[model samples]
Target: MSEFTSMAFGSAWGVKDWDESSIAPIIAREVQNSWRVRGMGDFAVGARECGSATGMLEKWKVLREDEIQKLEDVKWIGYVGVRDATTTSMAVGDTSQPTTRPWQQMIELRYGFHPEVWGKGFGTEAAKAIMGWCGKYIGAERFIAEIEIENLGSGRVLSKMGFEEIEKEKEVIWGMEGTKEWKIWVGR
Candidate 1:
């Protein structure tokens, strides 16, 4: 994990690999709040059945944060990172699908930023840094992201980072109507 912690930085921000340090609780709270702010929706209903903040925090044990103390240009916005998809039941992708590559080679990317930084390019910047770090240190060859179809801002960020729409699925989101989920994929 120390290898993953040595994350690269962009001009405006950097990513610290998710860890159980004092920063973990902060990252957990932000990760929870950012989901709704980033357009995933409220978890008032079916929180556990659907992908609630509590559920996600437990599912995505591997996360990363862009600590403001580590940056000089912007306030602490949120997190952007990847996790081993083969090992975890991904929120979107069909984990049952088989891949010839090793489990470590395929990863799922997730990100969230404060509303203030929504229109800014920080998501792309932080995403690029994390992807670069994973590719170099984790030997990750494939990256994927599961986003709500309505989250065009995040789609734009993924597009900017060279991700392509690999698939889409319709599902019931907690406390919301059926929503379309877009699973984007890219190769390093």
Candidate 2:
């Protein structure tokens, strides 16, 4: 359990241990946001088309098991919820969900935080702990991320993690479809 508190909010936030039970909220949040689900790289056209994409529940069931057994998979997945330092409740503006590239590859990272917690440093803290765990346990030597052109906030978090853009590579983001290219970042 990495203790990640927000200096900006004067409140505590940390990456709670990964658990099989955490799947529900992660799934619930994914279902709640169509855009977030699309970024998952699972559905057709390389992104989720709708909230009701076929086999989502089934897919998530497998994902839950995968998270539990991430080390055996090609890409390692870790999940944690930001919680109130005092109460340990999920209700208190604990809205960041970190996304990563497929476990088969370089273990890229992405994150989304509730708007309320933006700028309070929660995202960066969660990201550091997530990346740290990946580096230490999974032997991930590099962290790659592709941010949408408009997602500057996510870009900032990548920067905070010491990830820098690969301006000239022209490499397409894996699984993302059709000409809507995203910018790439790499952290060593």
Candidate 3:
């Protein structure tokens, strides 16, 4: 976990171990927001969508003690949260459904910051730090992110991080029709 210490806000974020109680709320929040914005039915729908898309249904479907343990046990996976130093608001990133493809690891980088912190470079900094961690500690040869095509802000973030647009497809998993998703990849 010391590898995560050098990340932006990593020292202040704090935590070496995760349990169901600690991780559920974060997963719940991400699911709730994903459902609301993408019009997915709810957390369950979000879970199913992630399962179908990435096959790591167990990780995104629900929060449980075993899931936390599973995540902790993955030598190639890393998860982290970003927090405001003064306000204590947090954002999550690090894991998504495992990619169905064998050559690449499918991951989602989700970020949530207080409105006050928006437009700052904090998210980008945190993202870059995470990417570095992935490359150094996780031995990740490549990473993938799926974002709504309309999400220009997120697109900018990915572009700044050197993720290239690889493909786009219509996805109906989140109870939304004609949802265009951009599949971006980071690595050689």
Candidate 4:
């Protein structure tokens, strides 16, 4: 865990192994923000079902079990992250690509942080660290993201990290229909 943490931590924040105690704060923060739920739908594992701590923990355990599934089914390889007043989660996983590009491995990257830390650069820091780990451990060659059009903050973070916009389309975000901007971050 220390080796992994060293790879994802910086001066202000760092990724930590999942702790059940931390789930409460995350759940408390998330259930109150529909945008957070919608923005993080794909990578959150159980955003819709996370209205309660027990439910969220149950879903997380299932995700942990499913973590061992075939690569194609892998939707989240993530870490729980903490900074002074911030709690975040980061994930990278194999995402579905167009049938026309069956051979292209589109690894998707995403992060969710408590609103208290919004605009504080924790998102960028955590994303940088998680991406660093994914590059080293998963050997991901390319990464993609589907962000809500309203989430300019996340888009800005991606821009800072070199993710370029590729497409825009309407999609279900956290069980609600909305426009999503797709972007890709390529490894150099």
Q: lDDT per residue, candidate 1, 146-179, as tens digits?
A: 5654566777887877776653343211112222
Estimate the TM-score of every prediction: 0.50, 0.40, 0.41, 0.43
Ranked by TM-score, the better of candidates 2 and 3 is 3
Best by TM-score: 1
Backbone clash tally for model 2?
Answer: 4
Candidate 2 lDDT tens digits, 1-188:
13112222112334445677877789566545533422222121111112344632223222222444333322212232211111111112333422234432344454554454456565676667655555555555555555554556666776776776653344333323211222323342
True-structure Cα RMSD, model 1: 16.0
- By TM-score, how accurate is candidate 2? 0.40
Q: Pairs clashing in candidate 4?
A: none
Q: Write the per-residue lDDT of candidate 3 for residues 1-188, one digit (tens) a residue.
A: 44333231223346458799998998788666544432321111112224344444234332343643343422222232311111111122313442233332433444433333334554566566555655565454555443445455556766887776643233211222222233344455
Give candidates' CA RMSD values in order: 16.0, 18.2, 17.7, 16.7
> What residue runs in model 1 are displaced by over 4 Å at the alpha carbon?
1-74, 90-101, 168-188
Per-residue lDDT of candidate 4, residues 137-163 (tens digit): 545556565555566777888899888
* CA lDDT for candidate 1: 0.49
Give residue 120's error in model 1 in angstroms. Answer: 1.0
So what's the TM-score on candidate 3? 0.41
lDDT at 71 for candidate 3?
A: 37
Per-residue error (Å), model 1, residue 2: 33
lDDT of 2 at 77: 25
Clashing pairs in 1: none
Count clashes in each candidate, considering only residues at least 3 apart in sequence or on different chains: 0, 4, 0, 0
lDDT of each candidate versus the true structure = 0.49, 0.41, 0.42, 0.45
